[model samples]
Target: MHKAGIPLPNDQVNADDVKAVQAMSEKLWKMDLAEQRVALAVLISLCDCIVWWTQRHK
Candidate 1:
């Protein structure tokens, strides 16, 4: 018999997250040289902030 308090299994991934990733990839692919450079810079900045916040809590 199944336990009363146990959580059920999730059989499918979220489609919206998948779609966002796909859209980002497509944008990166279609970006011009200048746009690509700016996009990369923004991504690096965001990553740095994330890392800093994570380290601060430790």
Candidate 2:
């Protein structure tokens, strides 16, 4: 398989480069509700950071 390209914010959805996410999902599924909330918060924070970083360069 060819190397997957960097996906743009609005690029058409495709099934590639999600192994890490799948792993995270499995781990989260095993966690209790409280732990899941913490994990979700962490993911949201990372998203915020990425958004800030991208806009900072534009």
Overall lDDT per candidate, in order of appearance: 0.62, 0.59
Compose the digit string of candidate 1's lDDT tens values, residues 15-35: 778876676566556656665
TM-score of 2: 0.52
Best by lDDT: 1
- Residue 43 lDDT in candidate 1: 68
Pairs in clash, predicted candidate 1: none
The Cα error of candidate 2 at residue 9, in Å, is 26
RMSD of each: 15.4, 11.3
Query: Can you tell me which runs of candidate 1 are displaced by over 4 Å?
Result: 1-27
Alpha-carbon TM-score of each model against the true structure: 0.52, 0.52
Model 2 deviation from the true structure expressed as Cα RMSD, one decimal place: 11.3
The TM-score leader among the candidates is 1
Residue 15, model 2: lDDT of 60
